[model samples]
Target chain A: MLDISVPAKVLFHLGPVPVTNAVVAAYVSTGVLVVIALLIRRSLSSEPGRLQAFMELLFEYIDNQLLQAFGDHTRARKFFPLIMTLLLFIAIANQLSVFPLIFQVLVEDKPLLRLATSDLSQTLTLGLVVVILSHIVALSMAPLKHIGNYFRIGAILAIRSPKDIGNALIEVFLGIMDLIGELSKIISISCRLFGNLFAGDVMVAVIVSLSAFTQFIVPMPFIFLGIFSGFVQALVFSLLSIQFIAGLVNTAAANKEARLNKGKQAALEQPATA
Target chain B: MTLVIRFTHFSTHMEAEAMKFLAAGLCMGLGAIGPALGEGFVAAKAMEAMGRNPSVADKMVPNMIVAMAICESTGIYSLVISLILLFVV
Candidate 1:
């Protein structure tokens, strides 16, 4: 009697495109977020009201988290919008998904609204976006160093004696591993969110179907857990994104600093030798 | 001879089903151990820090949670694999 599957049920075709219930649910959550944002913007005041104050508090809290992680004000500010967008969207979307009542409305014999993040495609896209953006940021910050990170061309070129060949080979292998690590980063991030949400859904469903009486009150704790974990996962996702991006930025900065130090050392030594 | 053959066929089919369930169960059970220990350690350290310095307790909570979630991801990966084995495979 209980149907559990990975793929979201497609509601109908929109011209040429097939629209799944998860997409519609995602749109609803996004709409809800946009409406709240618009309302807060409209009521903007120097003297903070309840909504404005709460919004400010939320922003400042996440900003503090980012500041703590990044340890640099400019870099934190640079990435704030992306991080904030991710946090708010995911938090709201995930929180909205916990209510089982949303799934009762049947369309074409399937649930009209399903948990959006539970869908692999959506979360994978989110992970891909975060990872790709981090690379883009790193590339923009230090193009040559970022490229050299994935390709050990410099290490290979630096090799002169036979003894250096082993080290060069190791560097090349490590570079390849770094590329694989990037791919795994996307998979881990996406799968973590999807598995948590899908498991929560399954747990609640199992609890509710145990008995007629159990369905009345037994699902409360599971739902609460779902809501709590939803917010936590959202926070984790954004924080992880910040950490990944900051790491790339730090690596680039370190590379530039080392290059500058090497140049300075060369200049000082050339004058001494001359 | 025919009856013996039928029983052998049925037993093999039953054995495959039993093995599937066993694999899924083992996957989840073993996978949960590392994350449980890691999360416990993270909490223990956070508690220790909070007890030492009450002022930073609020700050430590978010970091503690982030670390715990990171620890939990491996368990979730195993859960996903098990779920796939149980349902999709």
Candidate 2:
């Protein structure tokens, strides 16, 4: 029988906490990543082996991506570790879903390991972290300006004459909308990853259960699709994170520049009118 | 002769269950149309750009995929809704 459940099944309890198969799988993947990183670090040398060469290439690719997005070295350098970690972790977690052995290990009749990315909680947490981190970066860059970006109180306060009231009110409304848009960003990103991974799992499960013959080779194409999408999604998620972080800072700086330009123009015009 | 109102619990439950399936199917099927068209348009444009500037294919490829992923978010939203309809509610 094919049983499809949206939520991860709880495998056991630890003290007061319940642990699901997804959590166990996530821990294993994290440990694997940590071990690989440590091994590579300890084996570093001037002359490169195949594994070292591959790791160098991956790091260069990520650096190039960050450079392309930020168009400068400073911000890219600051964000490299966060962006690189996100790319590696997501890619590993996503690709690890296809390991066949994970399906066979059962504890108490429940599968011991399931795809971590297939769980909404896991993806949602990732999305939340990225979005919140961006906000924190923005706040650190320019606190008042970042706060002003979402609340047009400054605009309202700066309205000297009654003639500007209409524009100030409109700016206030748009600010509220921008605040909501940030919340939607969290939902959109997490849901995109979760839906793609879970749908891929469902498709493969359905194909495998179609018939006895399907158990032979029918799932190969579907599995290939899953693998391709996993990589593409990892790339997309990292790229979007870089964009979000850089975009917030860029917009704030641009706004400040524009405001300065406008003030200068007004000062020049007032002297001429006087 | 007296007219009586009938309430068949089993039949109503079955009807509701069938409608849930229909709703999920329709939600996914119709919701996919916009993203499909949008992604097609994006891919076509990206291919055209790559063909014109073959040297920049590397840059264009990643940008194209990112745009397509953003376009696919609406479809993902619907997929989430349909999945909820199917498995949750």
Candidate 3:
């Protein structure tokens, strides 16, 4: 029986920096993705071929999701490329386990390529990117208001009396909580993807090792489950990214609504006083 | 001295055996129950929703799958613990 626990490492050095199998796997996956993209791009026609049609279906599905998520068709179209790429990369990485060579050839002394999502570094990096991008998008759409979100700059700058000190304290505390929540988002997003993919890989390894007879058929059901799981994890990551962006947009909307309501109240009070 | 030493050794062996069994079997066996119930409940709810609006299965199924994965995490944790006990211990 092969030792599935050990990963095959392909080593390369740039200056003093040593690159390992995980890095190679990421590069290889990226290359594969590029090739797939090129193939889809080349195959496009006035009347769609089967491959083009299938690709279009997937694209349209993701495009619709982006529309629903951003609540603006123009914004959705702009962000679709990045979000769709993330979804595709994750989905492919998750399903890479099904490739027989991944286990047989890749599992020598060290893994040449472990599933990209299974690596903690990769998942965490991806999570951080998502969070950072969400924040950037929020800032771009509502510059002054979004800046105020993190520091409550408006509240701090507008203090008119000593009693406002209490409100400012509350705002500072809420700001701290918001910062912690963002950090927790990074941890949860990374851990959730890592835990699921790693557990599935471990399960299949153990199940196959139990008995040679069981190897052929016993792991089939779990493999099926893993495929379903791969798709879900991909969707969850993308949806969570969308949700974060949506929340920021909604917060800006809410701030606008509050200002409008306050303006109305001020207008009504003026007439009453008169 | 010999008699006391032998008694201590026997008790240690028995304790190890008990720990091995409890860690490997009991943790996972018990953990499976909650996930099973949770998955079934989720599936039932998802099915009801799908039945009401069959056209939305594409959206619904993906959401259901995400919900199921979260529910499955408990079971996965138990399995990880059990495997650790069986192999690493």
Candidate 4:
């Protein structure tokens, strides 16, 4: 009885682009987020109101978690914006399905609002963005070491004899494996959220069609569960992203250590001269 | 020959559909067993963590959610497989 498919139903075309319901839902959510942000911006004051106080408390809590995860305030501050955006966007997108009247309306036969989190394209894109951002952040700070992590050509080239050749070959193999691991992270992260949310959506669709009389009251609990699952999935997406970002800190730390060693050597030489 | 196939279709279709149905049922039941145990393992460990240090409950809860989501992947995979058998065939 459930008529859902992986390809989000096309609503209309925009100059050759087929705009789907998922895109519409995403845009509407984005609009909601932008309006809320603008209102909050306008209401900014030294004296905090209830909404501002609540927002500040959330920010503080997230920042506290970041500090705990990164173990450094400055590092946490650097990543707070990315992590916070992911959490807010995902949370809103997930909860969009639970709000009534939006998902039921049809435009040319297809419903106008399909949950964005349920779409593979959306989640995969988000996962790819997180991974790419991680690499870009790492690459910006430590270009050579980040490059070496996935392609250890320099290490391989330095092999002098037959004995060292085996070690170099192993390093090359491990480097390739590491690159594959990064790709796998995108698949796993995207699919895990997609699977959970999509399964819930399908289950509800099936349940709603089971009987007309019970439909009104039967789905109430599932709707509540949907809201809870949305919150959890949103948190999971953001937390996994933060973990990926945190993974890069080690290389950055090593880069800093190298610089600090040079600085220490310079300071030692200065003391001797003095 | 065609009428024979068409008239007796339910008998043949029944076996095929039954096998498909059985595959789906088996897929779900077998697939769920591992994740159930793994999730229980996660909860048991989280309980241990809470017992050890109740103050870290907030941290443990989120971490547990993330881990549980990851662990649910196998069950999700099974669900996907079952759905394919039910719908696509």
Candidate 4 C-alpha lDDT tens digits along A125-233: 9999999988888888788888888899977899998899989989999999999999989988888777778878887888888888767888888888888888888
- The DockQ-derived docking category for candidate 3 is acceptable
- lDDT digits (tens) for residues A1-274 of candidate 1: 5777788889999999999988998999999999999999999999999999988998998788789877889888988999999998889889875555788889878999888998888999999999999898778777899999989899999999999999999999999999999999999999999999999998888888888988978888988999999999999999899888888887877777788899999999998999
Question: Which regions of candidate 3 deviate over 4 angstroms?
Answer: A1-10, A106-108, A150-172, A250-274, B1-38, B52-59, B70-89
Candidate number of the best lDDT: 1
Report the candidate with higher TM-score, 1 versus 2: 1
Q: Rank the candidates by lDDT, best first.
A: 1, 2, 4, 3
User: What digit string (tens of lDDT, one per residue) describes model 2 on residues A124-224?
Assistant: 99899999998887776667888988898988998999999999999999999999999998898899999999988888989988999998698999999
Return the clash pairs for model 4, or none: none
Candidate 2 has a TM-score of: 0.87
Clash totals, every prediction: 0, 0, 6, 0
Q: Per-prediction DockQ, in order?
A: 0.77, 0.71, 0.27, 0.42
Let me know the TM-score candidate 1 reaches against the reference structure: 0.89
Q: Is candidate 2 or candidate 4 better by DockQ?
A: 2
Worst 10 residues of 4 chain A by lDDT: A248-257
Return the candidate ranking by TM-score, descending: 1, 2, 4, 3
Which segments of candidate 4 are over 4 A away from where they belong? A39-50, A158-161, A256-274, B1-26, B52-55, B80-89
Error of 2 at A52 (Å): 2.4
Residue A14 local lDDT, model 2: 100
